[model samples]
Target: MDMDVRRAAELARIELTADEAERFGGQLGKILEYIDKLNSLDVSGVDAMAHANAVYDVTRPDESRPGFGLEKALRNAPRKTADQFIVTKVVE
Candidate 1:
């Protein structure tokens, strides 16, 4: 487990002191033990699911409505042509 900790730290480019290595090695060992315990469980009768509860889209339905005209939409523009706002060239 200590070796695993050292290898993982090396792969992650992390510098762990001896004390930190020992502490983390013990923690990792406990986590792996718990995983092993979970693997021993009998889950054959259980159904797989993406979520524990049913999920549904709760958004309001889309509805078209009257919109502000071009003049009102561009009322605050600092620069505008006859029919549209003029913006600085962004791509070229």
Candidate 2:
């Protein structure tokens, strides 16, 4: 068992204990069998699917509204000038 396990591990370039190789081989065989069952299904007429089939409400009349962000916007700043945020000078 150790020789077979070691040889298989060497062929795959993986380090596996004697127990782990046997364990993984059984698990992998089951997964491959499940995939084969899925491949046997006939989806000959089903269309390739997208996430959802629906249209969104996208059209609305634009309206003019007064904005209200002069005071609260600059309240947390260390420096502000005339209803605008004052940032540090970058150019000399």
Which of the numbered candidates is closest to the native, going by highest lDDT?
1
Q: Write the residue-wise lDDT of candidate 2 on 1-92 in tens digits.
A: 12355676799899887789878778776777677786788999988765577656797679867675778767798987887888779999
The parts of candidate 2 lying over 4 Å away from their true place are 1-12, 41-92
The TM-scores of all predictions, comma-separated, are: 0.40, 0.32
TM-score result, candidate 2: 0.32
Please name the candidate that would achieve the greatest TM-score relative to the true structure: 1
- Residues 41-87 of candidate 1: C-alpha lDDT, one tens digit per residue: 89999988998889888986698878999978999999999879899
Provide the overall lDDT of each model, using Cα atoms, as 2-decimal numbers. Answer: 0.87, 0.74
